[model samples]
Target: MIDETDESLNKSSLVFGNFAVLVVFVLLVGGVYLWVSKKNKTGQQVFPAGVNYLSPKGDEAKKPVLLYDFAKLAESSDWVTYKGKIYPFSFQYPKVLTPLTFPNDRSDAVTFKVNELSPEQSLLFTVETISSRDKNLVGKPEEFAKNYWKFFSGLKALNKITKITNEKGMTGYQATYVVKGKNAITSDNYFFVVEGDDEILLHIGDIFPTEGKAVLNRLVNSLEYKK
Candidate 1:
């Protein structure tokens, strides 16, 4: 026979165990409800705000670098492809940069100010298209590139003229000069190609070595001719 005292103890233990489980379940459900109901002063849920605040800042930090990676992988990335209105040649530039076009210039000129880099003088890019008639078709593109600096007064190239061959084997020339009264070195790039009977000269200018010379290099290297 079962002991009477043992039966009483068993009944009491069962009641206490059920009560303990019920208490725990209630606490858990209540905690979830409180968390779900929490909101800001404007009655918007806090969790979404928390996620938005944290997630976007982490992504925002990476954007500037993606824009600044001019040499390594910009053309392959999300940069916008631009075909010159002044000329038929095409190239890619960072999407974050807005293009400023000149309508009245003798040569079709486009300028973009690169804000990602830090320098006292600021990094600026200017490109123009000059016809063979304007420059007077003379020698090869490299020869014209070497002699073209003579037009500018008091500005002499500080570095030796360098020949740059792009991925397509298209050749371009680069020259850097120390401008008077400026602390930075100014870089100039030139690419020559023929379209029909016209010898086309494409010029990109004024990138500081201390600031964004790689960007200038990338831009020059990215050039493509339709003609």
Candidate 2:
């Protein structure tokens, strides 16, 4: 009877030991699973090696400047009325020609004029009406870009463009091109243009390097037109 009792107690103990082992195994497996899930949730793994980290809050990185009011510029007398249309009065020295108008079939059209100070030195300004569609006009920006390089390609070219920026710190380009002739005389031409919805302004002035580019930039920046 004592042997039988001992056997029964040993069996019970073995069963209890097995149950305890199983509970420990289950607890270890659950802990491992929870740790792996937590790591994935925090984006701690390297998805692509050597890739740079990006800021999650990128929208708050940049602040934009406020544009100047267009209406306030229109009221100034610096604007002169020509052919029933008002244009900003430019400096008188460079000498602007009679503006030539080109009528597009649509409500938007283009007007162009060339200001020639000398045989090899000239400035061209074109004012065009713009619409939503016109914003993406083919070669618009490229054509404007060529003005800077065109002077460099001409024969006996002695010109360089300087201090080019647009009005509103937005849509505009400017440059000063200097030209030298065979007689060793030198001339400077300055060009500026501002674009708007109903009208555009073009300024071409003779460059006086000693006078610096600030004068021309101020004039271009100060330009205002009627809506």
Best candidate per lDDT, number? Answer: 1
Candidate 1, residues 149-210, lDDT tens digits: the string is 44443344444578776765666676554333334333454554443433555666543232
TM-score of 1: 0.52
Candidate 2 TM-score versus the reference: 0.29
State residue 71's C-alpha deviation in candidate 1, in Å.
9.3
| TM-score of each candidate structure, all chains considered together | 0.52, 0.29
41-148: candidate 2 lDDT, tens digit per residue? 663322111011111133522222212222333233444323213444332111122333334423222122222122122222233332222443333542433343
- Model 2 pairs whose backbones collide: 158-178, 159-178, 160-178, 188-207
Q: Which segments of model 1 are wrong by more than 4 Å?
A: 1-76, 115-137, 178-185, 195-198, 206-211
